[model samples]
Target: QSSNVPKLGTCITCHGRDGIGTSPVFPNLAGQKSLYMVQQLELFRSGARKSEMMNVVAKSLTDAEIEALAAYYEGLDPGK
Candidate 1:
């Protein structure tokens, strides 16, 4: 239930603490629609999205971890 730690350690590096992404190539996760994030994460994990890096990372996530991460990003404020 508590996924904050994993999100910080695993996501913050490229996604940024605010989830706005470190650069233009990385999409902003903050305030993104939850369903969208979930779907995308699932695709990434399943190797359907076709990103080498994402595939590797996403494949390691458990379902709970994926949901928790999506929820965390969905709750963030990109404008902040």
Candidate 2:
């Protein structure tokens, strides 16, 4: 299951290696709600969410991959 998603680096390019987000413009995905994350990614893939970057990335990913990513990011500590 974990093997399906690309390495963390692939996610890090935009979301940051730690999933903390590099800027305020990018939502802090670390320790985010998994349900919300999955929903948003599904939306992006389905065009319900409108972002060129997200759409492109989500479109190619399978459900398992999405779930894995959601789980991975949601597990982050994200210390405040």
Candidate 3:
């Protein structure tokens, strides 16, 4: 893991440190395409895609932070 990824972030409450969702309500983020993640995050931040939790989480993120998160999650191994 690099500086792009936080050792512990708000995402960890639902999506675990390894990108696995802790609950059924949260989709697993591991191995997701960075492009897809960035798109979804942008939508969520803009309130175009509705998710109470995601919107709040994304709202505080800058574009660079969003990209960093997408890269971090995209780099994770889903098989692990």
lDDT of each: 0.82, 0.82, 0.87
Give the Cα error of residue 54 in candidate 3, in Å. Answer: 0.8
Worst 10 residues of 2 by lDDT: 1-10
lDDT of 3 by residue, 1-80 (tens): 64546433788789887889998988999999999999999999999999988898889988888888888889889999
Residue 2's lDDT in candidate 2: 32
lDDT of 1 by residue, 1-80 (tens): 23444645677778877787898888888999988988988999999899988898999888888888888888888789
lDDT of 2 by residue, 1-80 (tens): 33455655566777886778787778788899989999999999999999988888889889888888999889887885
CA RMSD per model (angstroms): 2.1, 2.4, 1.7
Give candidate 2's error at residue 26 in angstroms: 1.1
Task: Give the per-residue Cα lDDT of candidate 3 at 64.
Answer: 85
Q: Work out the TM-score per prediction.
A: 0.88, 0.86, 0.91
State which candidate has the highest TM-score.
3
Candidate 3's displacement at residue 12, Å, is 1.1
